[model samples]
Target: MASRQTRLRVISLYKELHRLGRDYPDPSYNFHGKLRGLFEKNKDLKDEAEIEKAIKLGEYIRNETLALYSLRKYRHLKRMYPAVSPTDPFP
Candidate 1:
């Protein structure tokens, strides 16, 4: 039997992933498909240890996704407004 905390974490992770997926490129196809496939693939996991491992992996993936999004946003901003170098001061 899974603990209440574990179950809640699982639910939270699932919802967060889907929510983030909407912001992901190709949300309708690639992101959703891959997300669904991953959960489905692990649907039958019964061992507590395995489930915990999966949860940890999911958390890691979530963090990575956020990092990627941040990097992409930063790049886009940089492209729009190129950074000024300290050595080259002036408009």
Candidate 2:
């Protein structure tokens, strides 16, 4: 079980991620486009092995970008507010 501080931090992170998802016009604008462009430009990633590698790489990029954004927003909130009692469940 998380302590009150940890739980509050997690709840705050969720809220920020929700906000970012709504405010972000282009979800793929960050890593998806960049990685797709990278793969499209690469001539060597045409075969099955290379294609799989590209797909994995793209997935990694997307996950990493999302995780970074989540952490960034969490930090932003941590700096902005103190821990609350979490009156309601994380939305």
Q: What is the TM-score of each candidate against the true structure?
A: 0.82, 0.47
Q: Give all candidates' CA lDDT scores.
A: 0.86, 0.55
Best by lDDT: 1
Model 1 spans > 4 angstroms off: 26-29, 85-91
RMSD from true fold, candidate 1 = 2.4
lDDT of candidate 1 over 1-91, digit per residue (tens): 7788888998899899988888885445688778888888887888899999999999998998899799989889989997788888695
Residue-wise lDDT of candidate 2 within 10-41, one digit each (tens)? 34544544454454546666634444457457
Question: Which pairs clash inside model 2?
Answer: none
Task: Judge candidate 2 at residue 75 and give its lDDT.
Answer: 94
